[model samples]
Target: MQFKDQLDFVRQHVKKNRMRIFTTILATTMGCAFLIVLASVAFGLQNSLKKEVLSDDTLTRIEVYNDGNKEIEPTEIKKMKNVNAVTMNTLIQTGNLEANIDAYKGSPEVILTDFKENEKANLKLSKGTYPEKADGVVVGYNVAQILLSKEDEKKLEKEKDASKINIGIQESMIGKKITLNWKNEETKKKVTRTFTIEGVGPKPKKEWEQDGTIRISKEHEEALVQDLKTLYGKKLKAEEMIYRTTAVYATDLEAVTAINKALQDEGYATYTVSQQLEEMNLLFLALKAGLIFVGTIAILIASIGIFNTMTMAVTERTREIGVMKAIGASPKLIQRLFVMESAYIGVIGTVIAVIISYIVSFAANYAIPKILYMATNEKEFLTTEIQFSAIPWQLVVIAAAISIGVAILSGWRPARKATKIDVIQALRQD
Candidate 1:
């Protein structure tokens, strides 16, 4: 038979049993939809985690600690292979700076290192410029909020404080001199000093954001450390004194492992995001495997239903099959007609499943983040802006192909049976 004639034969068969075909398609649709939802969720979670943990900072960054009580020298660390930059949080002595502003509730304990060249890469600034003078200090995004008075904080809750909340006004916190009261730890004498705010950093997206921290130049930190020793009348050894923990960022992500190894070899304790990424991958891999296992059960049930339906279809069309055989219709052609009908059912079912899955995915990604952010008023609570269900095109193609293959395979036995019908015997069936 010509291709058109064969297609017409299959088309008529499907149209004649539209109601049964619809039922079969519905079963397959439910199974495919379950698979789509599971796979999309798995992919979405993995994508979100990659962004949150592996953002610009952590991808190339490694935290170095002096677990052996030895001094960590940044200069020495810089000489290591793949080490792009090294910076330490500075310890601001209360002795040098008398007191912070009364409006600022907590004292800042961390300071940004004054590396002339790589400072921009190490941090993201939201406002103003880096501290250039002895009396200037930079603040983190949270620190900016901390600078507000109790009254202002109450106003923020009501969205009433419009002045300071503005971007330009908030950034204008720079150059404002905040008085600090410092008392000598041993002498019990109090002194006062004022420092100007130099810059403000953007809000932290992850734990890596140095929130509630302030930045002073490295020169000022060294000078303050020296003054503290002089006031206490004691010589402090490097081992006894805790300076700061340094973060050594590699040139790129691939270099993090090598640099971490180099740090460990040099007798330093180190932490890297790369190690965390491996653990996360293992966790998601297990989750995906579990989802696939559950999805396979659904598909198996659908396949059985479809196979049973196809078998019954051949029985109902017995006389038709015999008539075709009597007309010299090839058994292969007859078999192919049934298989193609089943495959078409699978294709239609899969298409419907994909459409429904995407509609659900859109609602999930859009609403979840906003709902969480409002509940907690914390950016971290929202995690990354990852879709709750992100179905990639590659996955869609693979799923469609699987559905079609299952349909064809499941119908094979019934198709073969149809081809084997005895012409005279099938023709006499009432």
Candidate 2:
């Protein structure tokens, strides 16, 4: 048959059964829409999970401690295989400085690497030089004013009270004089000295920002902390010990396990982030798969419903099918027309579903952001934007396959029945 003849036959019948056609298309559209939405949402959830896992700073820094001992022996640690350079910094309990700042003594909060030449690596010297001359020091802003001063001047200025100096000396206050005090723990005697503050660091984080506290260079740090340790007769931790080595980064999980054995042989301890990342990654993978699995089931149900509707359509038009065959239309033409109708509905539904999903995504993405702003009571959380609009190609492909294949398959039974219909009986039926 000519293409025009075939087209006219399909269009005329479609209009005659307009009500059924519209209902079938509606169901298909809704099914497609549901699948599209499911796919997009799953993609967003996966991305959000990734952000949460990677945003942590601690994940980047491995925590190394004595495997069996409370404190690792320096010689034992040094001999361990796969060992990176060891660095020591005290990890004291959190406390408020004498000036009233809430702080973690040895945390990155109090760690400073601000000299101009520090980029060449290894905390190098800069203009006005390193803190080595006469006990001068480069310190973080928090504890800058505490050395010789009895009270914080900044605090007093803000409160307008001569006694309350609330602000810790900031980084700009470098090159100022300050007193540091310590005592030998074993001797139970006190020792104190003063020095010129050489450089300052950035303002503390919100959690770290308080009335007063500070970080000092190795020279000043030793003068203040070493004295207390010696007096107390406390040994330094291996992680807290300083060894300048050329190697970079903590060991991987597998390498660490092997190194652990090597360390045992050498009487040293091992450390790596491998164990922690492995555990976290496994959980994340399973979680992502579960979400996608649930989404796929939903899409499948929708596709199946669409297919069933198309099948019913082919059945209802059986009498019309016989008439078309009697009027010089070939059986092949009849089948083609039925299949084409299914394809038409499937295409329309897919297109409409794409548009609908995009609109829903925009509104949902915006609504959550606004709600978060109101709840957090802070501007930072509100401004932390995430890209949630991910078009899942897997979903689109699945929809296309399900819609087309189901439409054709469902029409098969009805189409074959129509072909067997006796023209005389079909026409003679009431």
- Count clashing residue pairs per candidate: 5, 21
- Model 1 Cα shift for residue 389 (angstroms): 2.3
Please give, for residues 1-430, the per-residue lDDT of candidate 2 as tens digits: 7888777876786788777777777766776667666666656765665565554322322335544554454445545565544444443222212222222112122332223223222433233445546455455544444432224443454576433444343444556655433434445565445557665544443432442323344444454445545544467543343322111123443455565455446544444444545675687567545654565455455556545655676567666766877797777777777777667666776777778877888887777777877997665556654646555677567666765565566566556655676777777655
Give the Cα-based TM-score of candidate 2 against the true structure: 0.62
CA lDDT scores, all candidates in order? 0.75, 0.53
TM-score of each: 0.80, 0.62
Q: What is the C-alpha RMSD of each candidate to the true structure, in Å?
A: 4.6, 7.2
| Residues 40-76, model 1: lDDT tens digits | 8988999888777876456788888878666798899
lDDT of 1: 0.75
Cα displacement (Å) at residue 412, model 2 = 4.6
Deviating ranges (above 4 Å) for candidate 2: 1-18, 58-65, 69-166, 177-179, 182-226, 233-289, 296-308, 323-336, 373-381, 386-389, 392-395, 398-430
Best by lDDT: 1
